[model samples]
Target: MDFVLVHGTTQSPAGWDRVAKLLTAAGHRAIAVDLLTPRDLPVEGYAQHARDQYDGERPVVVAHSGSGVLLPAIAEALDARALVWVAAYIPDFAGGRSLRDEASAVLEPDWIGVDPTADPAKASEFLFHDCDPETERPALDSLRLFNPAVLAAHPAGAAPEVPSTVIVPTRDRTLRPDWLRRAGRERLGVTPIEIDAGHCPHLSRPAELAAILTGRA
Candidate 1:
């Protein structure tokens, strides 16, 4: 299957390198979109941008971290065959809250309006703690500031009706697993598939994550 991997906030397309490579080795095409450029898009705009990255059969759209908010619209734009969320936020369709509000308690205090780049130490501690030393370095170096406009805008539209899978990193420090579980149940109405890794499982557990994404796990 073809896959479109969407990285989260303050992250670059390079973050998906490990997982994308694994998928490609297994004979699947993968596209990791560069969502940071023209860093002025809202949720819908990002969805369209991701859609434009590929032209082929409906791909399985995978979302990581903050990129989760883009999935609903992306599914529509791409007419996605399936949606895979890896430790991602499943937006509350109630339309009253923003992604920042959903992540406020878990995110660092200075996550917004202060610095666009992620602190190296914090990224090590929270996002890449479970990754290999080599994997963690590139992941950290690839971090970039996200579109602040995305944080403030509430995800519009209901969750897409495509087949969906939600994977919760059991050891996540950035977004607690308990909250991930609850969000998966409450927002997406699916029991999350748990994995033993931190926030960036694609780096720490690429083969395992790849298996799950491809339904081998």
Candidate 2:
């Protein structure tokens, strides 16, 4: 099966490197996208970029962190087979809360004007506290500045019409596990697949993460 991996805000395709490598080694195709930047683009624009990356194949669309809101649009555009949320923000459409609003309530206080790339120490603490030095260092070094505009944008109208799964990192400090569980249940209506790792499980536990992705776990 094909897997189109979408990284969160400010993150590059490199974030999926380890997981993608493992997926390929196991005989599945993995396509990781570097989300469009400047964050000024509408949600549709982000979805279009994701759609454009497709090679005319209906892949399982896997989104991480803030990119969850875009899954509905991208899935519609690509006719994706399934959707996977990895420690992602599941927008509450029925509750009338946009993904940005939900995320801002949790993340904006600390991240608003801070440049992730400029403050490796802070970034490391927020994103990689559970990661070992070897795993955390490179991630910190590659951190990019998050686009404020993206955080300000709202989600698309409807929920994605595809099979979906939510993967919650049990030890995640960035997006607390309890919050993710409530959000996943209320928004996506699915029981989360819990992983004993941090926010970036693809980096911290690639083999385990890959097993879940491939339906072997």
Tell me how far the alpha carbon of residue 173 in candidate 1 is from the true structure, in angstroms, after superposition: 1.1
Error of 2 at 73 (Å): 1.2
- Model 2 residue 188 CA deviation (Å) reads 1.6
| TM-score against truth, every candidate | 0.90, 0.89
Q: Which stretches of candidate 1 lie above 4 Å from their native place?
A: 105-118
Worst 10 residues of 2 by lDDT: 106-115
Judge candidate 2 against the unseen true structure and give its global Cα lDDT, from 0 to 1.
0.77
User: Which lDDT values do the candidates have, in the order given?
Assistant: 0.78, 0.77
Tell me which residue pairs clash in candidate 2: none
Global lDDT of model 1: 0.78
Error of 2 at 76 (Å): 1.4
Residue by residue across 101-211, what tens digits does model 1's lDDT show?
766754544433433264688777777788777787787887776755675576546767877888999888766678778877877788889999988898889999999
